[model samples]
Target: MNKVKVLLAEDEASLGMIVKESLESRDFVVFHAENGEKAYEVYQTEKPDILVLDVMMPLKDGFTLAKEIRLENKHIPIIFLTAKSQTSDVLEGFNNGGNDYLKKPFSMEELIVRIKSLLNRIELKPNIENIKIGNYTFNFTKQTLIHSSEIVQLTHREAELLFYLVEKKNEVLDRTFILNKLWGNDDFFNARSMDVFISKLRKKLRNDDTIQIMNVRGFGYKLLC
Candidate 1:
């Protein structure tokens, strides 16, 4: 499985590092941003699986940044880290679609549990849609890919690769995870085979201008539209 990347956005340098280190110890890859503007940049570039934000920050506020992130990724979890603790404020956090909110001075253990709980909830959400890629439609349940009146069959491995790629669409997928999950090892031969499969899928998807599979050298591939 891919490690979850979290963005820790807080203006306080010391607190930001503390939260970031704490999450890092839990096996989460964290990006720390001191201000709201910088935080939003990380949100765009890092595309973290979870966002831990402070309510007060320079340039942009937590509520505003959360609102913008909601527009892009409705499913990504957002958690506010703030000292402010009023009924109305908590209500406002939910109003902006936060999955969880952690009050400042929170224990590391509490944060970890909250993060795990939210991630569990995210995983439980149904994954049923037959994804649409330009003229092609991927029937996930059927494990079939169809394009412009023609249907293409996939071996089990190919199907799984497609599933992973689609699941991380618009985000970088680590090569190591894909190799371990599908090939059972991150050997050079397996990597070559994976590349071949990616090429084949690209050919099949050539008609779709809305989707592209890009290699993010040294990191992995990013499927984007």
Candidate 2:
């Protein structure tokens, strides 16, 4: 079996070494960089399977590096490591094409689990047909939404959320259920992140008047088409 390659971009020297050693002990090939600029350089050469980037780094921040990487590769899983817990920061990470987020002071075991989860998600390829939503056609596999020759590229989380909404169209999807299903926890931060994605999907589908993602007070969301 080929060892999974992980690009870890963290400015803090001690933390970087600890994370590198921890992942290596678990059989992962970790390419550790102390700054985002060097991380980007390593990324281009090594073509890592996944990226673990710290939000605060010299030369290039994690979000900036992620945006640059997204221009070249849309499907590679990227996870942000940040100390900030604000909703806006979470939203920003997703906007920059991150597939997941892990707050700082996270357990090594938790980080490992998240990495494996994302990698496993990438490996699973289900033959799902294109789904229609009002004036748009959603290609889950392609991570795109198309309408009248306009194609809107979706991040991995956006695609997943939209697919779930499509699956439960015309019915209320409990907020707790969605949080658990996608984020693995229904905590405050994850809940805020879910809301951010919801807002984004609403904007993406705004072209069609017939499509609505209505929030059910005290419940979840319902996709009306």
Q: Which numbered prediction scores highest in TM-score against the true structure? A: 2
Candidate 2: which pairs clash?
A: none
- Each prediction's TM-score against the native? 0.56, 0.89
Instruction: Report the lDDT tens digits of candidate 1 across residue range 143-172.
Output: 468887888855334555777888898899
CA error at residue 170 for candidate 2, angstroms: 3.9
Which pairs of residues collide in candidate 1?
none
- Residues 20-116 of candidate 2 have per-residue lDDT tens digits of 9999999999999999999999999999999999999999999999999988987788999999988888878887988888888899998998899
lDDT against the true structure, per candidate, is: 0.77, 0.90
- RMSD versus native structure for model 1: 16.0
Per-prediction tally of clashes: 0, 0
> So what's the TM-score on candidate 1?
0.56
